[model samples]
Target: MGFFQLLMKKKELIPLVMFMTVAASGASSFAVYSLWKSDVIIDRKGNPEPWENVDPTVPQKLITINQQWKPIEELQQVRRATR
Candidate 1:
């Protein structure tokens, strides 16, 4: 019999299959989160650079970009009028 057919005959395996799917998804998500939170940086020479060595101007540039992209007040007024 085909693998799917076997699964159809054994209904008890449904819960086990669901549990394994959830477990695998949770493990993968945790791995992605851990990588995102990691501050370790690799240099061009295959050396790890300390977080303190990162450029200080990067944060300042980000702040300037955010300030430049502020939302237009006209759009908010239009939305309020429509409501």
Candidate 2:
């Protein structure tokens, strides 16, 4: 049988194949995004320059702390008071 017919006969493999394809595509996309977001400075010759020569104008991505959660100490105090 041809490749397509063989694959059709094995219906159980379809979901696994689809999941792997999607997972691979997502990974590739994320890899490209990370590379694009990197701070490497390319020279006129299309090669990356040293880290010291990179432009300082680009803003770095900052990690934000979640302010929604109350402090554990305060929570403990409140719980003790309520009891």
lDDT of each: 0.64, 0.66
Please, what are the lDDT tens digits per residue for candidate 1 over residues 1-83? 98678779998988898899999999999777655432634353664545535544345331355443444699869968988
Residue 55 alpha-carbon offset, candidate 1, angstroms? 11
The 10-residue segment of model 1 with minimum total lDDT is: 54-63
Check candidate 2 and list the clashing pairs: none
- Top lDDT: which candidate number? 2
List the RMSD of every prediction in angstroms: 15.8, 15.5
Q: After superposing candidate 2 on the true structure, give the runs of residues whose Cα lies further than 4 Å from its correct spot.
A: 40-83
Measured by TM-score, how close is model 1 to the native structure? Answer: 0.48
